[model samples]
Target chain A: MNLFQYVRPAEQKTAIAAVAAEPTARFLGGGTNLLDLMKRHIMQPEKLVDVTRLPLKGITQQGNIIRIGALTRNTEIAEDKTILQNLPLLAMAINAGASAQIRNMATTGGNLLQRTRCPYFYDTAMPCNKREPGTGCGALEGFNRMHAIFGFSDKCIAVNPSDMNVALRALDATVVVNGPKGERKIPIADFHRLPGDTPEKDTNLDKNELITAVTIPISPFSKNAYYLKVRDRNSYAFALVSVAAALNMDGNTIKEARLAMGGVAHKPWRLTDAETFLKSKTATEENFQQAAQIAFQGAKAFKHNQYKLKLGPNTIVQALSVASGLKSV
Target chain B: MNEQEPFCPNESRRSFLKKSTVITAVALTPAAAINAANNHWDEHIAAAIENVSLSVEINGTRHTMDIDPRTSLLDLLRENLHLTGTKKGCDYGQCGACTVHVNGERVLSCLTLAATTDGSKVTTIEGLANGDELHPMQAAFIKHDGFQCGYCTPGQIMSAVACIREGHASSRDQIREYMSGNICRCGAYPNIVDAIEEVQKGGQKV
Candidate 1:
């Protein structure tokens, strides 16, 4: 890594200004992704504004909403009593993603902003529009085994690698951020952006804007929530097709449902249509299969990831089956 | 820029005299320090220009070093202070060979910036034992043969200790799940889980 300026600002605004002052500067969180990116020569920041000193590490609940500070470590959030009790889907998803050591170091805010695991994006030698625009996407034609099955453009076939994000989208969480302009709340769905023509932009968050916290309204699906991840391995691997399925059940009928899938799109692929279809329907394997089919209506698969076309529905049905208590976990 | 705390350097096993003299020279006079650091003048100068003051208590000894802000805690242990027991398997978070306890929580040292650990307490594999006496987890690893080639042993031990402490070692499957971060390329996972289970079952403080 090249030599660069590093500043540890104590306050949130000071940290924001330090990053805003230098266009090439970036905010340093847990440094799990940023440091690795820098070492790989994929990202080169002239200055790093360290925000670890900022007092933004806590989980607070107000009435029905729970607010998690930006710097709260993944392990902290996963193991918190209230989170496991109320938002167990988030806990299950976070725990399912990485190992315990990584979860200990990774922060909640940093997890949301993690880049794609697409091999092309990590390999600078490859032509990746996400790395450098107009470079041409190597994954689009090259071995796209881990590429997207939805929300992909002709320019990029990468997928967001965060399992935490998939659960957050299902819970309808809101991301609170502070920038030079002011503070604003972005719903989790809007927080991450699809790699449209501009594959370089991963999120709707502007430059120098710091994520302060994430708030989630008390969920109704806590009793019947499940995060099912299918990966190359049973443990310590990214999901090939993961589902965060939650249901509000009235006996055997589904009062409501929130569903999202990971490793299939540039963002957490929220199955709004599937969720809409499952409402008032009986919670059964046949209904889940139908919902799963509806969720993948617009999903487009690549050459190597055609297995996802089959794996995707299986994962969705499995998640919904377990979450609805039609089948055991 | 503040009072440097010294937590009893009277019994340092790694020649605290020479290290403290070098630290004093570096903090007081750059000319003498540069001469002392002649081998790494390039990194020293660059890091000196944007020096971030970091004071960390490692294994009971306090060290305040000027580091390149990008210097990871793994690099700090292996390079700066010569405490190389903590292995750097992947140099990234993927492999947990750089596992260390930061304020009693196990974290990947390779992913942790030295500057970010300024006021924190760090414990590496080198610090697990009390002088010559091994920790309970270490003894259990020996009894159960938890490693082969021993490259990933240090990180596995650190993470194992943490797994038990975090109450994640309740079952064999849970131990494997929690310790998945520390990958043993030699495939000593079954024995590793046995060792952790023994330590947990023995009810020994790690």
Candidate 2:
């Protein structure tokens, strides 16, 4: 790690100003990913503006929406009574992502902005277009078992490694960002960008913008939602092909549905087609299987990750079954 | 100003002043120096070690010291404060060997920067015991034989204490899931779970 100046801005204005003034400055949330990347010499921010102290730690419900402050820790979000009752899918997805220790240290904003867990990005010796644009992508031709199978660019095949983002995308959440200009709300679907030619830019957030909160609208999928993750280990591992399924059922028929997948693409891969297909359909194994097939319409797999073609659908079917009460949790 | 007496034996006074000016500029403000370094200012490497004042309370004892901003909480505890019980396994967040409590929440000390923890309270493995008396979690670990090589026991016990307190220890599966952060190469997971279960069942305050 390199020696850098540390600034803890108590006010949001101060924090935003500090980040805007310095091109090499980064906002420190939980410091789980940023610090790890710093120790690996992957990112060398000249100054770390610690925003943990900013007044953005609230988790409240305003009528039909649940607003989660950007600095709220993952553990708190997972165990909060309101979230557990209203957004159980988000709680489950967050709980399934990391261990308790990490959950304690990781904030909602930090989790959403977390970089890829691609090995090539971690190892500076290797070439990663995301880590260093024009360096060439090592995972495209190298050991890419964890690489993406959807929305992959020729420059990068890395997957977004956040379970919480997938749930947020499915919930149709909105990200509240504060910047030099003012505040703006970005729909969660457009928050994270696919690895196009510019894989360096993870989210749609501008350099001067700082995430303040995330708001999710009240929905009927509260009671019937599941976050199913299949990993190498049962816990404390990134998802290989995780599914976040939520169904608003009209008795036996699906009134509405939301589906998103992790470990599949550069961003949270929302299954808009699958979600549309699931509406008005009977919540059964066959319908879920058909929806899963629709979800993988344009999914292109790498050499080592071809198994995701099978596992992805299976996980989706299982998640749908669990969420719809067809299968036991 | 002293042209006759050179600061260095071989260097000229004018060159020495130029070098000293650069060093002084870097020492006074590191952001400019970092910018210079980013632009390949290799000569100012000596002035890059920026020191920051940190006031932290550890194990109920408060210490105010100047530390390099790059120093991790784990390194500060083990190297600076001599609290070595908090082991460093992977030196990254992957291994829980550096697990410690920050404001009563278990966090990987290795990933936590000392500068970021200013005015915060931390509890390490060394602080588990109350003078002569062992914490219930520590005693339970001993009674249940929760470790073999004992390298990862400190982190396991710390995490177990947190897991129980956080209400994640209601069942064996939950304990396993919560304590998954601490990896035991010796495979003493069953015994570790037993320790946590006994402590949770005993109703002793952790």
Candidate 3:
């Protein structure tokens, strides 16, 4: 392992300055993902600024929305009463990710920044555009089952592997970033970027910019939300496919709907087309089937991930139906 | 940067010196003091970039060390201080192999840097034994055959203790959920659950 300097800045300014001074410097949160990547040489920083000690480590409520600090542990959020009651989708999403021990150590921000578990990305020996752009994407042909289906360029096919972000996108949450320019907000849906031509850039946040907090908008919509994750294992595994849906029904007609998908795109895919189609439609089996089909309208699929084209819609429909108190076939 | 109360060093060399002044006078005869100072420096330079002083109370014992800022609590314990009971399975927090108690709450030691845990109470597997007696959870693991190969046992035990503390030991499902982090590839989960259940039930079978 390469040796590096470590600084535990007592103040946030000093920590930011440390990163600004050395662009290769990284802020260490729970180190659940960062240290692992560092050990694998997937990420190597010349300096590590310990950010766990910073005062940005709490979950607070502003009106009906819950603003979670970047440093708040996944375990804390999963167990918080406010999150469980108001945003059960967030709680369910957090619980589905990682294991209990990992949840105890992983911070909210780290989860958002988690890299894909694509074998090609992790094994530097393999050609992965996400890991090293223009090298070519090996997973485009090899083991492409777990790769992306919606936002795939010729260069990369790796999916954005975050259940929490998928849930946040559906709820229309916003990320508060503190960077060289000071405080700014990015809607969660726009926080992560698609792999348009450069798969290397996973997010819009520059290298020096730090995610300060994630603020979910105040809404009663989340009260009827559900996060459904389908994976190979019952525990300690990443999602093969997952859905986050918030459905509000009036009698039998859908009053409102928000849907987002995971394990299917470069970033969380919010099915806005499906939402618009379902708004005034009855929440019956036929209407749900049509809306579900609308969600996957322009989703381009790879050879192996064609199954996700079906699984994605089915997963969303199942979650939405359950949340809407309708029978899921 | 602010002054948090530093815990007095436990019954190690520092505490021994603190308790017995007459013994320290004889024990710190030139050669011993020089050797003691050297040992201190060796521990301090484990990661060796900046001298980060910390007071961590392990088990019931307080230990003061000037650790390297890069030192993880797991590395500080296993690599530098020789508390090897906490295993480093994945080195990542994905596996619960390096679980330990931070202020009586279960935390992944591998993810925690020693500097971040300054003045916090840490309890490792080595500290779970009281002199010649083992902690009830430790004894339960042995009785129930909770391990085969024994790589993840220490972490499993540490997590089990925390599970009981966190009140998840009563239900089978909750125990499974809470202990889901610690994976035993050998598939000894049944025995591990049995052990945790025994410990939760007052550590003695009726």
lDDT of 2 by residue, B1-206 (tens): 01121111112432454467546654434466556555666523523334566778999999998776678999999999999999999987898989999989999999888877887889998888999999999999999999999999999989999999888999999899999999999999999999999999999999
Error of 1 at A323 (Å): 0.6
Pitting candidate 2 against candidate 3, the one with the higher lDDT is: 2
Model 2's chain B TM-score?
Answer: 0.82
- Rank all candidate structures by their lDDT, best first, as comma-separated numbers: 2, 1, 3
Better of 1 and 3 by lDDT: 1
Which pairs in model 1 have colliding backbones?
Answer: none
Candidate 1 RMSD to the real structure:
6.6
lDDT of each residue in A8-88, candidate 1, tens digit only: 766788888978887778988888899999888788776788776677888999999999999999988998998999999
lDDT of 1 by residue, B1-206 (tens): 12232121122422343355545444523233334333364455434545566788999899987676778899999999999999989997888899999999998898888877877889999999988999999999999999999999999999999999999999988988998888899999899999999999999888
RMSD of each: 6.6, 6.7, 8.3
Top TM-score model: 2
Order of the predicted models by DockQ, top scorer first: 2, 1, 3
Window of ten residues with lowest summed lDDT in model 1 chain A: A2-11
Give the number of the best model, judged by DockQ.
2
Candidate 3, CAPRI quality class derived from DockQ: acceptable
Highest lDDT against the true fold, candidate: 2
